[model samples]
Target: MDLLILGIVVLIYFLLTGYVGYVAWRRTETSEDYMVADRKAHPYIMAMSYGATFISTAAIVGFGGMAGVFGMGILWLVFLNILVGIFIAFVFFGKRTRKMGHNMSALTFPEFIGRRFRSRFLQYFGGAIIFLGMPLYASVVLIGAARFLETTVKIDFGIAFILIALIVAVYVVMGGIKGVMYTDALQGTIMFLGMIFLVVSTYYILGGVVEAHQALTGISNLIPAEAKAVGATGWTSMPVYGSPYWWTLLSTIILGVGVGVLAQPQLIVRFMTVKSNRELNRGVLIGALFIFVMTWSAYVVGALSNVYFFRKAGMIAVEAAGGNADKTIPVFINSAMPEWFSYIFMLTLLSAAMSTLSSQFHVQGTSIGRDVYETIMRRKGDRSVLITRVGIIIAILIAVVLGYILPGSIIAQGTALFFGICAASFLSVYAAALFWKRATREGAIAGMVSGALVSLFWLLFEYKKTAMALGVTRVIFGGPVISSMPWPVVDPILVGVPVSALMLVVVSLMTEPPSREHLDKCFNGIKGV
Candidate 1:
């Protein structure tokens, strides 16, 4: 790749991004605009922004890398991303969340839930969870983009990390959600087009789709000894049932992110951005198509890259990337794609990273400024927004630091871990708040606290991936994990979400129900629905 061409392309992309951020900042004259795009976003922009934010570099570079290692079985997540993330999320959750948010005059997700349950504690607690927990997720996203830059352009990881982080922070701090969404719409379009080209180019290069898939299946005998020992059958098939690989794929990779998306604070807040159910209804089809194209192409191309690598270098994707699953996609693109196409794909990745990071930073900032600080201080106005700007900078710095410190093969693992934690901590309470009229403040608090604690404990002591990495369990128990085989492999969401739901139902039934008046206020116009 020519340095001049790359520099020119990057400059153009940055200028465009800067212009869009400026436009959004100009439009954002009030706190409402900053928080929720003044609750009047277009259907197309809302749908695109939601999909873009939902599918980030984590999906492309991170999970795509996993596909290279694990095979097409990870395609299950694409199904769930569309079904639950888009369909059920928009139809069942989005409409209700929008109405309830408006009814409560809630600006942030924590604020919405807080007002619903009438608890300052829930509000601040939820905020604290986001502020503390989101850095892991955000940092992995930074790593995904930075890793791509490192592979393709030979840029230093630290420099790439700061450049990506700084560009996103500036826009999000200035334009808020409006800025995030505006850029998201533009970025989403680039991602969609780039992915279309990628899949088409990949199949064309390797032969037709049928030939490519058949080639992958024929090489099943080449499965790594370690992978096969753990139940990896082939790239084309599912892992052996009840095997270690099955547990990781089904529990951690699939269900962890699949079911966990419903509870995402960043995504839930998108529901409240549009005007009404009409926007969400329209968003369903657009979001689904975008997700299908983006996820399907990435996973397919990732798995098939094995065929390309084996043919060229006589190695599988993971081996070719030096054992780092996170580097597989970047390495594949750098090696296989033409120089011209590489430039386009680089932009696709940048869009994916910036769109998602912008949302994460915005959520983290608001969680602190509005949910925690404002609620605790009984304050609101420009001071809170200023605080949010400060919070965004802090969040960016934290993510950059983690990007530097985290090890390789972590992109997918980090993404799943954070999603699982969010599922356990927020999914039960968030679901109850939206649909269960009987859910009470005390129940919400109990369920949230217990779920978060249980999930954390499991991650630190039982889950092999995290427990082993942290070494807390090793120090305390003289082993990698405290549990036996299947338990160690099982994702925390399996244990945490169930326990959380039980606590929510039992506590709500035992404690006094929320006041009839408060319930009425919450369910005001949507009672029949």
Candidate 2:
């Protein structure tokens, strides 16, 4: 009987989402509309869409579970999400991105960067990176949400993953950016309400926020010896500074995603969805508030779940979830919340996963079609959209295959890896393209290639996750690390981003400056009077 009711609710939600996608498809006449919604999105819609895409199943399920193991120190990411991701991104980067995108008459992010520097190679390279790298991240999102469905709904993980991907692909292929943002607005609202209830309910169950935190603090001595050796202090405190655990949290998890948000092609394209600076400004408060409620609540609830599990089951969240941090939040919700709320929150997790996956699929498709096929191969008109739709289908299949094969514990790490690579490869050049008049085509190419290759090399040889996964360290180095130093523990971003930025500056200084007409066109309406 309860399953029937839940089915009805899910059906209604899907019907509404489908209707929105249909409307968007009907409205999408030109390729521009398919790519950027004709650049006329409202402030609220744009803000909600951005928030939805940013806070994915990775944040709620993967990172939330991380909070269960690592504790409240993860809240630093919330600060960065607001300060850097929202404030700096929307105000500083977004304003310039919108003006520059308009000035260049570019539809895709790669196209914008390529046109700014007049480099076809740069454009094709960026598109190829997106095509090759994004599926791993998309797979993580799939696994996170599928794990939740398996836990709460009694569904098989593979079936849930494929079903979710297929449904999202249908809307994305048919509706494009318009369909994506419209559904994102709705999903974002559901996510906000669900997370708000989760936080409040968790506090109520634990007697209050103060009491819950106190209980967590009192359990410091319960830290596993293995965890403590690596720098875990307690669920309520930061890891020991400069410890391997601390490096993993700060450098890999927090810094990777925090700074990496700037270079996300899907998020950057949001700036071009609106017409004027006013829309961007109007979106700042909404985006900030949405991000805060969504992120803060998840972390708080995740950390508090340790208290709840210890009291009820005499086990910590990770132990209770069978040693998988990715399972902690799902286990906690099923055990802590009422049966009905579990079903409702399942929808919340679904919203998180689907919203993010849709955006990723859309971006991947456009990267192949608009950035590669149209811009690089010279395809045009309606055929471009057709190629994009085909690309969306192919991207979905790749993500599903990856989701099926990846280890269950890799959700959070996978998300961080993709974010780190994106930041290392793109952020430096992107900043230069928007703000530096001296940024030449040669300089941009050098920075991008060097940054991307360094990140890849570090991941293969030094970063433990990929190195160990690939057996490079064990097979080649005959050790856990290739270096005697703690390079294995540090994220590639810390090294790659700096090298990339330095290369951008040094190469630009050495190369000839861009033409006067090019600089004027790129900086028009953005430069100071």
lDDT of 1 at 109: 92
Check candidate 1 and list the clashing pairs.
none
What digit string (tens of lDDT, one per residue) describes model 2 on residues 395-482? 9999999987898678889998999999999999999998788888989999999999999999988988788888876888687668
* Cα misplacement distance, residue 75 of candidate 1 (Å): 0.8
Tell me the spans in candidate 1 whose CA falls farther than 4 Å from its real position: 527-529
lDDT for model 2, on a 0 to 1 scale? 0.92
Worst 10 residues of 2 by lDDT: 477-486
Question: How does candidate 2 fare on TM-score?
Answer: 0.99
Provide TM-scores for the models.
0.99, 0.99
lDDT of 1: 0.93
Give one digit per residue, the lDDT tens place, for model 1 in 1-529: 8999999999999999999999999999887888899999999999999999988999999999999978999999999999999999999889999999999999999999899999999999999999999999999999999999999999998899999999998999999999999999999999999999999999999999999999999999999999899999999999999999999999999999999999999999999998889899999999999999999999999999999999999999989999898899999998888998889999999999999999999999999999999999999897888888899999998988888889998888998989999999999999998889899898999899999999999999999988988999989989999878899999999999999999999999999988888988998888563
What candidate 2 gets wrong by more than 4 Å, as runs, is none
Q: What is the C-alpha local distance difference test score of each model?
A: 0.93, 0.92
